[model samples]
Each structure stands twice: as C-alpha cells, then as structure tokens.
Target: MHVDVIPVGAGHITQDIARGLLTPVDHAERLKTYYGAAMQSPTDDREMIDVPQLGETGPAEDITSQLPRSVLTGVIQPRIEETLELVRDYLEAGGFDGIGARRVVLTGGGAQMPGIRELAQTILGKQVRIGRPCRVVGLADATAGPAFATCTGLLLYDQMAPLELSDERQTEAKEQPKGRLARMGRWFKENF
Candidate 1:
C-alpha cells in the first residue's frame, strides 16, 4: 500500500485569519475556538470573530472583525486544491496515477470543518469522508471525532510491537551476499 500525505491543519486557518483580516493574533487558543464555531456551516454569511489585539501599549482590547466566507472559498479551498494537485502530479510521475482514483479520507482537526469533505471531493473528483478515530478503547465522547484522530492513531501505534522478520526470512537475508546495492534495496524495502 502506498500512502500520500498533505499537511493541512488548524494553523492554516490561523494564518488565513492573519492574512485576510490583517491582524496579528495574540491568543491563538481563543481564536481557534472562534474558528471552530464559525466554520460549523458552509455558508456565505460573514462571521464576527473576537480577536485579541497584539501590539497594544497599556491594555489589550478584543478586535471584533467580520470573517468573510471568502477565507474558505478563496484561500483555504485553493490551498487544498493545490495540495491535491501536487499529490496527483507526484503519483503520476511515480507511475501510480491509478491510486488517485481511490476514496480520500480527510483526517485531523481540519477534516471536522464543515464542507471540507465536499470541497475535497469536488477538487479531487473522488469520494471523500471525514475520518474519525476507530476502535479507541475508553475514548471520551467529546474526543471521538476527527479532531482526535491523530492522537488516537499515535496511541494505537505506540501500543503496537515492532515488526520482526520471520525465521525463514532471516535465514534468507543472511544467506544473501551484502553488496552496497543489495543493502540499499533491503533498507528501502524494510523502511518504505
């Protein structure tokens, strides 16, 4: 199996806020809350986000700014399309173009945003689904969504034992003469 990854995170939204609103963010955590609430729906309506002022002398006042939906359509959506296009180009160059036809699973906090899956589907021309953490034991209900998928995956991965070659494979590996090319190929096959 071959997996291609694209880095799309909540930080992109924060950057978009800074760029679009032309405001330096003081409290990122508080801004994230506003982003989460504002992106609950895929609408053209403008949202009011209370952003903390950064370069203040004495007291800091919250800057109430109107967040236009263009942030989603103009900046965020274009970035997603560009990333997917890059992935498609990479797969094509590697002769794995057919892999692009498979369904896309959008994971992490950005996947929970409204209309993100639909936007991805439209861009990639493939079925898209928001991926949530699965088979997580004792996972709290609040953390069972796509936002916690990365954490759950890390926990699951940490619990897994390292893969060991079988006795037969170990014997075959030892019997083969270790040339530089052979060693390089073995390293690639093992890691990749």
Candidate 2:
C-alpha cells in the first residue's frame, strides 16, 4: 500500500515580507527577491528601488513606487526575527535543544538571502551555513540550487538505500509466529 504525503519545509520569509510591505504578494515577492536581506548594511542603504503599485488608476510608467533599501530592511527585519524565534521554539518543543552547538544547514529558497547565515547563527546559537545540491551527476543547472537540495537528497537516498536489509526486515515482520494458542484461537474463530 502506498500513501502520498506532503512534507513540510521550514521558514516563511517571503510571506513575512509580503505582510510587512502592505503590498500585493507578487510585488512583495519581487521586492524580497531583488532586495531582501536579514539586515541593512552600509552598501544596501545606498540603493533605491522602484516597485509596482497595486492601487487603482493602475501602474503608470512615471508613477513608479519608490522606497529606500533601508525601509525594506526595516520592514523585513522584525518579521525575520520573529520567524527565527518561532523556529527556536519549535526546535526546543520538539526536544532538539541539544543541537545548539551543532552546525545547522539552511537550504531552499530563503537561504539565498544575503545575511541569513549570520542571522540564523545569531538567533539559533548554532553554526549555520547555506546548503545546495551536491554530488548530483548530470544535474541541470536550473535545479542545482539550495531550493532543490531536499528533493535531490531524497532521490539520492532512494538510489542508495540497502535493499537487502529492508527486504529481510519486511520478511521477518510478515512471518512472525502467532504462537500455538493464538493460532488455535484464530482457527476456532474461523471454523465457528
């Protein structure tokens, strides 16, 4: 019997950005992709961004919505911090508190943010690094990023699992004896 399950991935940095910016999700998403970071650095403050407006009398070429990079930093920082706090709470409540000193890998789309490694390490008290797909032969360039690491890992694991041991375990489980009395009970019940 086969069952389909959706695995939950960690983090929602984009959604947090979307809510904080008071912009449509699509526009907010582009802002986050182009300019989002865990904090504002000196270099970031020098940049200005033009974003799409979702307001009525629609988007016009001359009326582009503009904001300083620092404003973006301000908007996203609290939300990212709150998200990190929730991640900490989740790990602790799930009895993973001992991982404090271990190295944690941040993968997937949000890991591409400029300061995520430093931010995660600061908040989670663990060494954090960005992880991308590795050891995949003939992997297309498009799917070789951090976002694809999980699926690549699953594929790799499926290829490498020790099948004989798994088969032995399954055989042993299926053939377990019910014992003489239990077998007799089943026999009597079936016959009756």
Candidate 3:
C-alpha cells in the first residue's frame, strides 16, 4: 500500500499576499487581483489567513519575532505529528513489517518546511518522502514544491493506475443458479 499526506494549504500561495506581508508583484501575485495596492482579491485556493491589525506605526518588535514560530508550532507542526502518528499506529495494527513493507509519503505545503522530513523520520521510524504528481501538462515545476503534491499525485494515479474491472470470471456457488426453486431452496437451507 502507498500512502501520501498532503498539507492543508497544499496549493495556495495566495494567503501570504492578502495579509499585507507580501507584495502583489511577488510570484504569488499571479494568484491574486489588486484594487489598488491595499484592496486585494480573496483566493479560494489558499488556506484561510488571519492577520492581527497593525497600527500606522506597525507591529511591535517582539510580536513579529514570535509570529513565525507560533504558526509553526501551534498549527503546522501539530498537524504533521498527528498525521504521522496515526499512520504509524495504523500500519502497525495492520501487520505491516517495518520500513521495508511500508512507504509513508508526505506531500503538501506543510511538508516543505526545512527540517520536517527529518522530524517525521525521527517520529515515524520509517522512510518518509515527498509525493510528486505526474502525467499533467504545465506541471514540470509543480512538484518542485510540496504544495502541489496531491494534485500532482492525482494526475499520476490517473496515468499509472487507470481504473479497470477484473476480466476473470467469478463463480459464486450460491449465486450461480438463479431460479425460483433455487432461491426457495437456498432460503429454506439457510433458514432451516
């Protein structure tokens, strides 16, 4: 079995812009529209963003220092740890034999964190790596980052594991003969 975890904000770089932290002219700009510099268009793709209001003079120094760390620990890290633990416990219960019999794939924006793969390895005690989607046009650079992993993987699955029904005939002894007597007999046999 192959398993992949996609981060919550997997495909959206737009949230970073609407919060006033990033300029529209940035790479994420393509994801947003501008009504002047201040009024930015909302993005459906990005994870919801909440920014504390800043006065004209701007935020305090200490507040800025704590912001990134707070987001990492409170939001991003917990989600990763939770997902990894659940997967580990599930695989163990299913009798999956260690790293060789298992593959844990992590994808999504959260997986792009600098030390996350190492952190996941320490916790999961299994090999964990990023997922890359395949078989789509205009996706050469999509897998370069974790944000597009799920969408990419979906495309890849479409290419590799195209759905098909089994061609072999199935012999169900009970279902093979269909008639009123057969049904009545089967019912009588089961019931009696």
User: lDDT (CA) for every model shown?
Assistant: 0.62, 0.70, 0.50
Ranking by TM-score: 2, 1, 3
Ranking by lDDT: 2, 1, 3
Q: 18-97 in candidate 3: lDDT tens per residue?
A: 23343222322332321111112243223343333333244422232212323323333444556667667767777774
Best by lDDT: 2
Error of 2 at 127 (Å): 0.8
Reference-based TM-score of each model = 0.62, 0.71, 0.47
N/CA/C clash count, model 3: 2
Q: Which scores greater on TM-score, model 2 or model 3?
A: 2
lDDT of 2 by residue, 42-138 (tens): 9767788876554536553344567788888787777677767766776666666684436667777767878878888899897777878876788
- TM-score of candidate 1 relative to the true fold: 0.62
User: Residue-wise lDDT of candidate 1 within 1-192, one digit each (tens)?
Assistant: 346565655667667655655556544444543454322354544654454455655454544444554443454555555665765576567655575457767677767665667666766666778878886668788888988876787788778856588999999978986999988888898899
Worst 10 residues of 3 by lDDT: 31-40
